[model samples]
Target: MKVLEAYDLVKVYRRRKVVDMVDLKVTEGKIVGLLGPNGAGKTT
Candidate 1:
């Protein structure tokens, strides 16, 4: 079963494309993490 799903996710800031065409899928009992440098939009 899919615990979470996303499609065509995009994020832009100040006319700059931070994230584009991102897709994600998480299964049950799965753990995921996103890590990046400062201002990389890891939490954006």
Candidate 2:
């Protein structure tokens, strides 16, 4: 079954498009991790 879904998710910062038209999905009963560089929008 579907657990989490993010459609057309967009985030802009400092007049710059950080996350543009992002689509993400996560299933149930699972551990998810968001891995990225130090400034790769991880803490944006």
Candidate 3:
């Protein structure tokens, strides 16, 4: 089970967390991609 799940995800700017405590899971015939460049936020 668990087709998709995300927990403890955080994003902050100015205070500068940016993305912290991030967790992600994908199961049951899964394909996932998260590539980063150009400010590195990746559309945060």
Candidate 4:
């Protein structure tokens, strides 16, 4: 089973591309961690 999914997710800031065409998917009872450096769109 799929819990969360994102397709073609794009986020830009100040005319600059931040998250470009990102796709994600998560299954049931799955624990996923997002890790990234600062300014890496970790909170986007």
The lDDT leader among the candidates is 1
- List, residue by residue over 1-44, the lDDT tens digit for candidate 3: 88889899898866778788889989999888888767867786
Residues 1-44, candidate 1: write the lDDT tens digits: 99999999999977879899989999999999997778877776
Superposition TM-score, candidate 4 onto the true structure: 0.70
Please report, in order, the local distance difference test score of every candidate based on alpha carbons.
0.89, 0.82, 0.82, 0.87
Q: Estimate each model's TM-score.
A: 0.80, 0.64, 0.38, 0.70
lDDT (C-alpha) at residue 11 in model 1: 94
The candidate, 1 or 4, that scores higher on lDDT is 1
The numbered model that scores best in TM-score is 1
Clash list (residue pairs), candidate 4: none
Better of 1 and 3 by lDDT: 1
Q: What is the lDDT of residue 3 in candidate 3?
A: 84
Clash count for candidate 1 is 0
Mind giving the per-residue lDDT tens digits that candidate 2 earns over 1-44? 67999999998877778788989988888888888666667678
